[model samples]
Target: MALTFLFRFADDVVEASDGSLYFSVASTKFGLHDWFFDVLEANLPHGQLLKYDPALNETSIVLNGLCFANGVALSVDQDYL
Candidate 1:
């Protein structure tokens, strides 16, 4: 089962060992015309990585403006995360 649906355009997600979650918010619009043009379209509202803390049952934005942030991956070492 899922929890919250506050995400606008969740393209990618990553989970940490400490039970923290990170995800990217791209664009919410869909259309070939809108996809090709528009600064916001190219920007795609990327770079905004969100974090979810289960202990507090809260979610917050960590980064913003990632420019079409579509994917995310973490290194083996949790430290890299």
Candidate 2:
């Protein structure tokens, strides 16, 4: 069977040196299907950045209270994020 809700409003994704996935969840109470509404409700923070370690099978919140936390990315040298 297929699954959904992997992450609500995941806007962007990037990879890290430790084989981890970094992403942004653009809303807490809204999903991608309701992305427009979230955008419309701008100025308020409902977004977050997360780190997923495939090896450890773990997921953690990196940042929160973001206003449309899109374009999740790492530094060029992978030194700062």
- For lDDT, the strongest prediction is 2
Clash pairs for candidate 2:
none
Q: Tell me the whole-model lDDT of each prediction, alpha carbons only.
A: 0.63, 0.81
lDDT of 1 at 70: 69
- In model 2, the runs with Cα more than 4 Å from the true position are 1-6
Question: How displaced is residue 79 in candidate 2, in Å?
Answer: 1.3
What is every candidate's alpha-carbon RMSD to the true fold?
5.0, 4.5
lDDT of 1 by residue, 1-81 (tens): 344545556778899888888876664343334533424566354345778888777888676666655667679896654
Q: After superposition, how far is residue 70 of candidate 2 from its true place, in Å?
A: 1.0
Best by TM-score: 2
